[model samples]
Target: MTDRDSVFLRALGDAASRLRPEVHEYVAGPPAGSRSGVGRGVFEIAGSPYRRIAGLLRIVSGPDVALDAYERDVPFEIVNRLAADGSRPRLDAERSFRFRRGPRRFVDTLQVGRIPGTLVNTPGTDGRVELLLECSVTADGNLMMQSRAARVRIGRRRIRLPKLVSVKVTVIDGWSPEHEHRTVDVSVRNPVLGTVLRYRGWFPYEYVPS
Candidate 1:
Protein backbone atom coordinates (compact mmCIF):
# COMPACT_ATOMS: atom_id res chain seq x y z
CA MET A 1 0.00 0.00 0.00
CA THR A 2 1.09 3.57 -0.57
CA ASP A 3 1.97 5.99 2.21
CA ARG A 4 -1.44 7.63 1.84
CA ASP A 5 -3.03 4.27 2.67
CA SER A 6 -1.08 3.75 5.89
CA VAL A 7 -2.77 4.28 9.28
CA PHE A 8 0.41 5.84 10.68
CA LEU A 9 0.84 8.04 7.65
CA ARG A 10 -2.69 9.30 8.03
CA ALA A 11 -2.10 10.08 11.66
CA LEU A 12 1.23 11.87 11.20
CA GLY A 13 0.22 13.60 7.95
CA ASP A 14 3.30 15.22 6.42
CA ALA A 15 5.44 14.16 9.34
CA ALA A 16 5.18 10.50 8.39
CA SER A 17 7.86 10.94 5.78
CA ARG A 18 10.23 12.17 8.46
CA LEU A 19 10.14 9.05 10.62
CA ARG A 20 13.33 6.98 10.86
CA PRO A 21 13.58 4.38 8.09
CA GLU A 22 13.13 1.51 10.51
CA VAL A 23 10.16 2.98 12.37
CA HIS A 24 8.65 4.07 9.07
CA GLU A 25 8.91 0.58 7.65
CA TYR A 26 7.22 -0.92 10.67
CA VAL A 27 4.46 1.62 10.71
CA ALA A 28 3.81 1.80 6.95
CA GLY A 29 3.71 -1.80 5.92
CA PRO A 30 3.71 -4.54 3.49
CA PRO A 31 7.43 -4.32 4.07
CA ALA A 32 9.71 -5.07 1.13
CA GLY A 33 10.62 -8.75 1.19
CA SER A 34 7.99 -10.26 3.39
CA ARG A 35 4.23 -10.38 3.77
CA SER A 36 4.31 -9.24 7.40
CA GLY A 37 6.50 -7.52 9.97
CA VAL A 38 7.63 -9.60 12.93
CA GLY A 39 9.85 -8.68 15.85
CA ARG A 40 11.17 -10.68 18.81
CA GLY A 41 12.46 -8.65 21.71
CA VAL A 42 13.15 -8.53 25.40
CA PHE A 43 11.78 -5.88 27.67
CA GLU A 44 14.39 -4.71 30.16
CA ILE A 45 11.62 -4.01 32.66
CA ALA A 46 8.02 -5.15 32.43
CA GLY A 47 4.72 -5.00 34.38
CA SER A 48 3.16 -2.66 36.90
CA PRO A 49 4.24 -2.29 40.52
CA TYR A 50 0.74 -2.07 41.94
CA ARG A 51 -0.60 -5.62 42.07
CA ARG A 52 -4.21 -4.53 42.62
CA ILE A 53 -4.11 -2.06 39.76
CA ALA A 54 -2.57 -4.67 37.44
CA GLY A 55 -5.19 -7.27 38.33
CA LEU A 56 -8.03 -4.81 37.90
CA LEU A 57 -6.72 -3.80 34.48
CA ARG A 58 -6.53 -7.40 33.35
CA ILE A 59 -10.09 -8.12 34.48
CA VAL A 60 -11.53 -5.03 32.83
CA SER A 61 -9.50 -5.31 29.63
CA GLY A 62 -10.10 -9.07 29.34
CA PRO A 63 -7.80 -11.98 30.23
CA ASP A 64 -5.30 -11.64 27.38
CA VAL A 65 -4.64 -7.99 28.11
CA ALA A 66 -1.07 -7.28 29.26
CA LEU A 67 -0.44 -7.93 32.97
CA ASP A 68 2.29 -9.83 34.72
CA ALA A 69 4.52 -10.03 37.77
CA TYR A 70 7.32 -7.49 37.57
CA GLU A 71 10.33 -8.97 35.86
CA ARG A 72 13.47 -7.99 33.94
CA ASP A 73 14.78 -9.16 30.59
CA VAL A 74 11.30 -10.35 29.63
CA PRO A 75 11.10 -11.83 26.18
CA PHE A 76 8.24 -10.93 23.83
CA GLU A 77 7.11 -11.57 20.30
CA ILE A 78 5.39 -9.02 18.09
CA VAL A 79 3.52 -9.53 14.83
CA ASN A 80 2.17 -6.59 12.87
CA ARG A 81 -0.23 -6.56 9.93
CA LEU A 82 -1.09 -3.51 7.87
CA ALA A 83 -3.71 -3.76 5.19
CA ALA A 84 -6.67 -2.03 3.64
CA ASP A 85 -9.99 -2.89 5.26
CA GLY A 86 -12.34 -2.11 2.40
CA SER A 87 -11.77 1.64 2.00
CA ARG A 88 -10.02 2.01 5.34
CA PRO A 89 -6.46 1.15 6.21
CA ARG A 90 -5.73 -0.42 9.58
CA LEU A 91 -2.81 -1.75 11.60
CA ASP A 92 -3.30 -4.79 13.80
CA ALA A 93 -0.88 -6.46 16.16
CA GLU A 94 -0.49 -9.02 18.88
CA ARG A 95 2.45 -8.96 21.29
CA SER A 96 3.06 -12.01 23.42
CA PHE A 97 5.05 -11.49 26.57
CA ARG A 98 6.76 -14.37 28.29
CA PHE A 99 6.37 -14.04 32.01
CA ARG A 100 7.11 -16.42 34.86
CA ARG A 101 3.45 -17.02 35.62
CA GLY A 102 2.48 -17.53 31.95
CA PRO A 103 2.55 -16.13 28.46
CA ARG A 104 0.21 -13.14 28.09
CA ARG A 105 -0.66 -11.21 24.97
CA PHE A 106 -1.57 -7.62 24.25
CA VAL A 107 -3.64 -7.15 21.11
CA ASP A 108 -4.48 -3.89 19.42
CA THR A 109 -5.74 -2.25 16.25
CA LEU A 110 -5.08 1.22 14.89
CA GLN A 111 -6.94 3.15 12.24
CA VAL A 112 -7.24 6.65 10.93
CA GLY A 113 -9.46 8.80 13.09
CA ARG A 114 -12.52 10.71 11.96
CA ILE A 115 -10.66 13.89 12.71
CA PRO A 116 -7.71 14.36 10.39
CA GLY A 117 -4.14 13.88 11.57
CA THR A 118 -5.06 11.49 14.34
CA LEU A 119 -5.43 7.77 14.96
CA VAL A 120 -7.74 5.61 17.04
CA ASN A 121 -6.13 2.88 19.15
CA THR A 122 -8.23 -0.04 20.34
CA PRO A 123 -6.35 -2.28 22.74
CA GLY A 124 -7.23 -5.40 24.70
CA THR A 125 -8.54 -8.86 23.87
CA ASP A 126 -12.11 -7.54 23.60
CA GLY A 127 -11.15 -3.99 22.56
CA ARG A 128 -13.55 -2.44 25.05
CA VAL A 129 -11.49 0.75 25.19
CA GLU A 130 -10.73 3.14 22.33
CA LEU A 131 -8.17 5.92 22.46
CA LEU A 132 -7.63 8.92 20.23
CA LEU A 133 -3.94 9.67 19.76
CA GLU A 134 -1.94 12.50 18.33
CA CYS A 135 1.39 11.58 16.72
CA SER A 136 4.45 13.29 15.31
CA VAL A 137 7.75 12.55 13.64
CA THR A 138 10.58 14.32 15.43
CA ALA A 139 13.56 16.01 13.79
CA ASP A 140 15.74 13.04 14.72
CA GLY A 141 13.25 10.78 12.90
CA ASN A 142 11.80 9.27 16.04
CA LEU A 143 8.06 8.78 16.49
CA MET A 144 6.32 10.36 19.45
CA MET A 145 2.67 9.86 20.26
CA GLN A 146 0.31 10.53 23.12
CA SER A 147 -3.30 9.94 23.94
CA ARG A 148 -5.45 11.49 26.63
CA ALA A 149 -8.99 10.87 25.45
CA ALA A 150 -10.42 7.43 25.90
CA ARG A 151 -13.83 5.76 25.76
CA VAL A 152 -15.06 2.44 27.00
CA ARG A 153 -17.78 0.45 25.24
CA ILE A 154 -20.38 -1.46 27.20
CA GLY A 155 -22.81 -3.55 25.18
CA ARG A 156 -24.34 -1.09 22.72
CA ARG A 157 -23.28 2.05 24.56
CA ARG A 158 -19.97 3.89 24.82
CA ILE A 159 -18.96 6.13 27.69
CA ARG A 160 -16.23 8.75 27.55
CA LEU A 161 -14.10 8.19 30.63
CA PRO A 162 -13.33 10.99 33.02
CA LYS A 163 -9.81 11.92 34.16
CA LEU A 164 -9.89 9.64 37.20
CA VAL A 165 -10.43 6.50 35.14
CA SER A 166 -8.87 7.73 31.92
CA VAL A 167 -5.22 7.14 31.20
CA LYS A 168 -2.60 9.15 29.35
CA VAL A 169 -0.30 7.02 27.26
CA THR A 170 2.97 8.24 25.81
CA VAL A 171 4.93 6.16 23.34
CA ILE A 172 8.29 6.68 21.67
CA ASP A 173 9.82 4.62 18.87
CA GLY A 174 13.13 4.95 17.11
CA TRP A 175 16.21 3.22 15.82
CA SER A 176 19.17 2.66 18.11
CA PRO A 177 22.54 2.77 16.44
CA GLU A 178 24.31 1.93 19.70
CA HIS A 179 22.33 -1.26 20.22
CA GLU A 180 22.05 -1.85 16.47
CA HIS A 181 18.32 -2.42 16.91
CA ARG A 182 15.04 -0.64 17.06
CA THR A 183 14.05 0.68 20.48
CA VAL A 184 10.76 1.66 22.03
CA ASP A 185 9.47 2.89 25.35
CA VAL A 186 5.89 3.22 26.51
CA SER A 187 4.44 4.84 29.59
CA VAL A 188 0.83 4.59 30.67
CA ARG A 189 -0.07 7.05 33.39
CA ASN A 190 -3.16 8.26 35.23
CA PRO A 191 -3.75 11.75 36.57
CA VAL A 192 -4.31 10.51 40.10
CA LEU A 193 -2.16 7.40 40.27
CA GLY A 194 0.97 8.75 38.55
CA THR A 195 2.87 6.25 36.42
CA VAL A 196 0.90 3.02 36.41
CA LEU A 197 2.85 1.02 33.83
CA ARG A 198 6.06 1.44 31.89
CA TYR A 199 8.35 -0.62 29.67
CA ARG A 200 11.37 -0.06 27.47
CA GLY A 201 13.19 -2.42 25.14
CA TRP A 202 15.23 -2.94 22.00
CA PHE A 203 14.70 -5.34 19.13
CA PRO A 204 16.06 -6.30 15.76
CA TYR A 205 13.06 -6.51 13.42
CA GLU A 206 12.61 -7.88 9.94
CA TYR A 207 9.98 -8.22 7.26
CA VAL A 208 9.26 -11.92 7.69
CA PRO A 209 7.08 -14.35 5.81
CA SER A 210 3.44 -14.03 6.78
Candidate 2:
Protein backbone atom coordinates (compact mmCIF):
# COMPACT_ATOMS: atom_id res chain seq x y z
CA MET A 1 0.00 0.00 0.00
CA THR A 2 1.11 3.53 -0.71
CA ASP A 3 1.79 6.11 1.99
CA ARG A 4 -1.50 7.80 1.19
CA ASP A 5 -3.35 4.52 1.69
CA SER A 6 -1.61 3.89 4.98
CA VAL A 7 -2.52 7.34 6.26
CA PHE A 8 -6.11 6.88 5.17
CA LEU A 9 -6.37 3.52 6.91
CA ARG A 10 -5.01 4.92 10.16
CA ALA A 11 -7.51 7.75 10.11
CA LEU A 12 -10.34 5.32 9.57
CA GLY A 13 -9.04 3.19 12.42
CA ASP A 14 -9.42 6.09 14.80
CA ALA A 15 -12.98 6.59 13.64
CA ALA A 16 -13.78 2.94 14.30
CA SER A 17 -12.56 3.17 17.88
CA ARG A 18 -14.44 6.39 18.61
CA LEU A 19 -17.67 4.93 17.28
CA ARG A 20 -17.85 2.16 19.88
CA PRO A 21 -19.37 2.80 23.28
CA GLU A 22 -17.06 2.47 26.24
CA VAL A 23 -17.75 -0.87 27.94
CA HIS A 24 -17.40 0.84 31.32
CA GLU A 25 -20.26 3.18 30.38
CA TYR A 26 -22.82 0.42 29.90
CA VAL A 27 -26.19 1.42 31.34
CA ALA A 28 -27.32 -1.95 32.60
CA GLY A 29 -28.45 -5.38 31.46
CA PRO A 30 -28.64 -6.27 27.78
CA PRO A 31 -29.41 -3.81 25.02
CA ALA A 32 -33.07 -3.14 24.41
CA GLY A 33 -32.78 -3.26 20.62
CA SER A 34 -30.06 -3.07 18.02
CA ARG A 35 -30.59 0.71 17.92
CA SER A 36 -29.62 1.31 21.50
CA GLY A 37 -25.96 2.25 21.96
CA VAL A 38 -25.29 1.26 18.38
CA GLY A 39 -23.76 3.17 15.48
CA ARG A 40 -25.24 3.04 11.97
CA GLY A 41 -23.59 3.45 8.61
CA VAL A 42 -24.36 2.97 4.92
CA PHE A 43 -21.72 1.17 2.85
CA GLU A 44 -21.18 0.41 -0.82
CA ILE A 45 -20.25 -3.22 -1.43
CA ALA A 46 -18.44 -5.16 -4.19
CA GLY A 47 -17.67 -8.76 -5.26
CA SER A 48 -20.03 -11.65 -6.14
CA PRO A 49 -21.22 -14.22 -3.58
CA TYR A 50 -19.36 -12.25 -0.92
CA ARG A 51 -21.28 -9.13 -1.81
CA ARG A 52 -24.51 -11.03 -1.42
CA ILE A 53 -23.25 -12.55 1.81
CA ALA A 54 -22.34 -9.10 3.11
CA GLY A 55 -25.87 -7.91 2.47
CA LEU A 56 -27.15 -10.75 4.62
CA LEU A 57 -24.72 -9.82 7.33
CA ARG A 58 -25.95 -6.22 7.32
CA ILE A 59 -29.60 -7.04 7.96
CA VAL A 60 -28.71 -9.07 11.01
CA SER A 61 -26.04 -6.82 12.52
CA GLY A 62 -28.46 -3.99 13.43
CA PRO A 63 -27.28 -0.49 14.45
CA ASP A 64 -23.76 0.58 15.40
CA VAL A 65 -22.71 0.97 19.04
CA ALA A 66 -23.40 4.22 20.87
CA LEU A 67 -22.93 4.14 24.66
CA ASP A 68 -23.34 7.85 25.16
CA ALA A 69 -26.02 9.68 23.24
CA TYR A 70 -24.32 13.08 23.36
CA GLU A 71 -21.02 11.83 22.08
CA ARG A 72 -22.43 9.45 19.45
CA ASP A 73 -25.01 11.66 17.76
CA VAL A 74 -23.09 12.26 14.59
CA PRO A 75 -25.20 12.87 11.48
CA PHE A 76 -25.23 10.49 8.52
CA GLU A 77 -24.75 13.32 6.04
CA ILE A 78 -21.35 14.01 7.55
CA VAL A 79 -20.22 10.45 6.97
CA ASN A 80 -21.80 10.38 3.53
CA ARG A 81 -19.98 13.49 2.45
CA LEU A 82 -16.69 12.10 3.71
CA ALA A 83 -17.11 8.98 1.56
CA ALA A 84 -18.13 10.96 -1.50
CA ASP A 85 -15.27 10.59 -3.90
CA GLY A 86 -14.47 9.22 -7.36
CA SER A 87 -12.02 6.56 -6.23
CA ARG A 88 -14.62 3.76 -5.89
CA PRO A 89 -18.04 2.96 -7.24
CA ARG A 90 -21.01 2.35 -5.01
CA LEU A 91 -22.79 -0.96 -5.53
CA ASP A 92 -25.31 -1.50 -2.72
CA ALA A 93 -26.32 0.30 0.45
CA GLU A 94 -25.67 -1.50 3.77
CA ARG A 95 -27.27 0.31 6.65
CA SER A 96 -27.47 -0.10 10.43
CA PHE A 97 -24.71 -2.64 11.18
CA ARG A 98 -23.72 -2.61 14.85
CA PHE A 99 -20.52 -3.58 16.69
CA ARG A 100 -20.42 -4.55 20.35
CA ARG A 101 -17.36 -4.47 22.62
CA GLY A 102 -16.44 -7.25 25.04
CA PRO A 103 -13.98 -7.67 27.88
CA ARG A 104 -11.19 -8.97 25.67
CA ARG A 105 -12.15 -7.72 22.22
CA PHE A 106 -14.85 -6.22 20.06
CA VAL A 107 -17.45 -8.39 18.32
CA ASP A 108 -19.91 -8.02 15.49
CA THR A 109 -22.40 -10.89 15.26
CA LEU A 110 -25.09 -11.29 12.67
CA GLN A 111 -28.18 -13.17 13.81
CA VAL A 112 -29.96 -14.58 10.80
CA GLY A 113 -33.34 -15.74 12.01
CA ARG A 114 -35.14 -15.75 8.68
CA ILE A 115 -34.10 -15.85 5.07
CA PRO A 116 -33.76 -12.75 2.99
CA GLY A 117 -36.66 -12.16 0.63
CA THR A 118 -34.29 -11.61 -2.31
CA LEU A 119 -32.37 -14.85 -1.86
CA VAL A 120 -33.67 -17.88 -3.78
CA ASN A 121 -32.16 -20.79 -1.89
CA THR A 122 -32.49 -20.86 1.89
CA PRO A 123 -29.35 -21.88 3.78
CA GLY A 124 -31.15 -23.62 6.61
CA THR A 125 -34.46 -24.28 8.31
CA ASP A 126 -36.16 -21.89 10.76
CA GLY A 127 -33.00 -22.04 12.80
CA ARG A 128 -30.72 -19.07 13.27
CA VAL A 129 -27.34 -18.91 11.56
CA GLU A 130 -25.04 -16.45 13.27
CA LEU A 131 -21.83 -14.96 11.93
CA LEU A 132 -19.63 -14.11 14.90
CA LEU A 133 -16.52 -12.00 14.36
CA GLU A 134 -14.05 -11.00 17.07
CA CYS A 135 -11.68 -8.10 16.58
CA SER A 136 -8.82 -6.45 18.46
CA VAL A 137 -7.08 -3.13 18.03
CA THR A 138 -3.35 -2.79 17.50
CA ALA A 139 -1.26 -0.37 19.53
CA ASP A 140 -1.16 1.93 16.53
CA GLY A 141 -5.00 1.98 16.54
CA ASN A 142 -5.58 0.05 13.33
CA LEU A 143 -8.45 -2.39 13.86
CA MET A 144 -7.56 -5.99 13.04
CA MET A 145 -9.56 -9.19 12.91
CA GLN A 146 -8.90 -12.74 11.79
CA SER A 147 -11.28 -15.31 10.39
CA ARG A 148 -9.09 -18.28 11.28
CA ALA A 149 -11.48 -19.02 14.16
CA ALA A 150 -14.57 -17.27 12.81
CA ARG A 151 -17.75 -19.32 12.90
CA VAL A 152 -20.96 -19.67 10.96
CA ARG A 153 -23.18 -21.43 13.42
CA ILE A 154 -26.58 -22.79 12.55
CA GLY A 155 -28.40 -23.31 15.82
CA ARG A 156 -26.24 -25.77 17.77
CA ARG A 157 -24.01 -26.78 14.87
CA ARG A 158 -20.91 -24.59 14.62
CA ILE A 159 -19.24 -24.47 11.23
CA ARG A 160 -15.81 -22.91 11.11
CA LEU A 161 -15.10 -22.14 7.48
CA PRO A 162 -11.79 -23.30 6.11
CA LYS A 163 -9.40 -20.51 5.20
CA LEU A 164 -7.57 -17.63 6.82
CA VAL A 165 -9.63 -14.49 6.90
CA SER A 166 -8.33 -11.14 8.09
CA VAL A 167 -9.20 -7.46 7.97
CA LYS A 168 -7.64 -4.12 8.83
CA VAL A 169 -10.16 -1.35 9.43
CA THR A 170 -9.67 2.39 9.88
CA VAL A 171 -12.14 5.04 10.86
CA ILE A 172 -11.84 8.80 10.37
CA ASP A 173 -13.62 10.72 13.08
CA GLY A 174 -14.37 14.38 13.88
CA TRP A 175 -10.95 14.98 15.35
CA SER A 176 -9.22 14.07 12.11
CA PRO A 177 -6.89 16.75 10.87
CA GLU A 178 -8.08 16.63 7.28
CA HIS A 179 -11.73 15.80 7.72
CA GLU A 180 -13.99 16.50 10.69
CA HIS A 181 -16.53 13.76 9.97
CA ARG A 182 -16.75 10.05 10.66
CA THR A 183 -16.33 7.38 7.99
CA VAL A 184 -14.94 3.86 7.74
CA ASP A 185 -12.74 2.00 5.28
CA VAL A 186 -12.48 -1.74 5.68
CA SER A 187 -10.59 -4.43 3.76
CA VAL A 188 -11.57 -7.99 4.55
CA ARG A 189 -10.53 -11.16 2.77
CA ASN A 190 -10.01 -14.88 3.06
CA PRO A 191 -7.47 -16.86 1.01
CA VAL A 192 -10.28 -18.83 -0.60
CA LEU A 193 -12.71 -15.96 -0.88
CA GLY A 194 -10.14 -13.41 -2.02
CA THR A 195 -11.71 -10.03 -1.36
CA VAL A 196 -14.69 -11.00 0.70
CA LEU A 197 -15.87 -7.47 1.42
CA ARG A 198 -14.26 -4.10 0.78
CA TYR A 199 -16.29 -0.95 1.34
CA ARG A 200 -15.87 2.73 2.14
CA GLY A 201 -18.90 4.79 2.98
CA TRP A 202 -20.76 6.65 5.71
CA PHE A 203 -24.14 6.70 7.45
CA PRO A 204 -26.16 8.47 10.13
CA TYR A 205 -26.09 6.98 13.65
CA GLU A 206 -26.93 7.84 17.24
CA TYR A 207 -26.61 6.55 20.76
CA VAL A 208 -29.40 5.17 22.96
CA PRO A 209 -29.01 6.28 26.55
CA SER A 210 -28.61 3.17 28.64
Per-candidate TM vs. native? Answer: 0.90, 0.37
Please give, for residues 9-89, the per-residue lDDT of candidate 2 as tens digits: 322333434323321122111233322334445434322234335445434332231111111222222111112125521
List pairs with backbone clashes in candidate 1. Answer: none
Candidate 2: segments with Cα more than 4 A from true spot = 1-134, 139-143, 164-175, 203-205, 208-210
- Candidate 1 lDDT, 1-210, residue by residue in tens: 244346777778777878877778767767455556788999998776665666778765655554756678989888888766788888888888888878767788888888877789989868888889888887889988899599988888878999998989998888887777888898888888887777789887777765
User: Which is the leading candidate under TM-score?
Assistant: 1
Which candidate achieves the best lDDT against the true structure?
Answer: 1
Each model's lDDT comes to: 0.79, 0.31
TM-score of 2: 0.37
How many pairs of residues collide in model 2?
15
Candidate 1 lDDT:
0.79
User: How many clashes show up in model 1?
Assistant: 0
